[model samples]
Target: MFLPEAWGRGYATEACTAVLDWFAGALPGEPVVLYTQSANTSSMRLSAKLGFTELERFEAWGAEQWFGVWSPLTLSG
Candidate 1:
């Protein structure tokens, strides 16, 4: 999802929400993971809005902090 110019427009949320719904139905009773930098407050908020729960926080790629495993419950179709 590379919308460089579409930042802060809710485009990412819209696109991700659709994908999440499809994936949830495609794989039922499983966990979906979404990872991003801890510094990216917008992404964190978006993930939360999409019902992704935090699993861990760690450092990676030299001085870059990351939040891992925004776990969302998969739905059965």
Candidate 2:
């Protein structure tokens, strides 16, 4: 995780993209799953930007959490 001071500047986007690219290359067409609290708007936006689709939402640990999934095919043309 990066320091709070490093929140913007696209670093997360770049790092996450690189990681996802590696995962896709390693496992052809596997999907990636993500979970985050609904209250985290930044995470929600990030998930959408990363092409993750909402799979479900549930209550956990006294908070509303969302489960999303991203498939390599999502952005593959």
Clashes of each: 0, 0
Residues 1-77 of candidate 2 have per-residue lDDT tens digits of 77888779788778888899899899978999999999999899888888899999999999999999999987754
Candidate whose TM-score is highest? 2
The digit string of per-residue lDDT tens for model 1 on 1-77 reads 65678777888788887987777678755677776888888877888777776777777876456554533443222
Candidate 1 RMSD to the correct structure: 4.0
How much does candidate 1 score in TM-score? Answer: 0.70
Q: Candidate 1, residue 55: CA error in Å? A: 0.9
Question: Model 1, residue 51: what's the lDDT?
Answer: 74
Deviation in Å, model 1, residue 4 alpha carbon: 8.4
- Name every residue pair that clashes in candidate 2: none
Model 2 residue 41 CA deviation (Å) reads: 1.0
Model 1 clash pairs are none
Task: Give Cα distance to truth, residue 74, candidate 2, Å.
Answer: 1.7
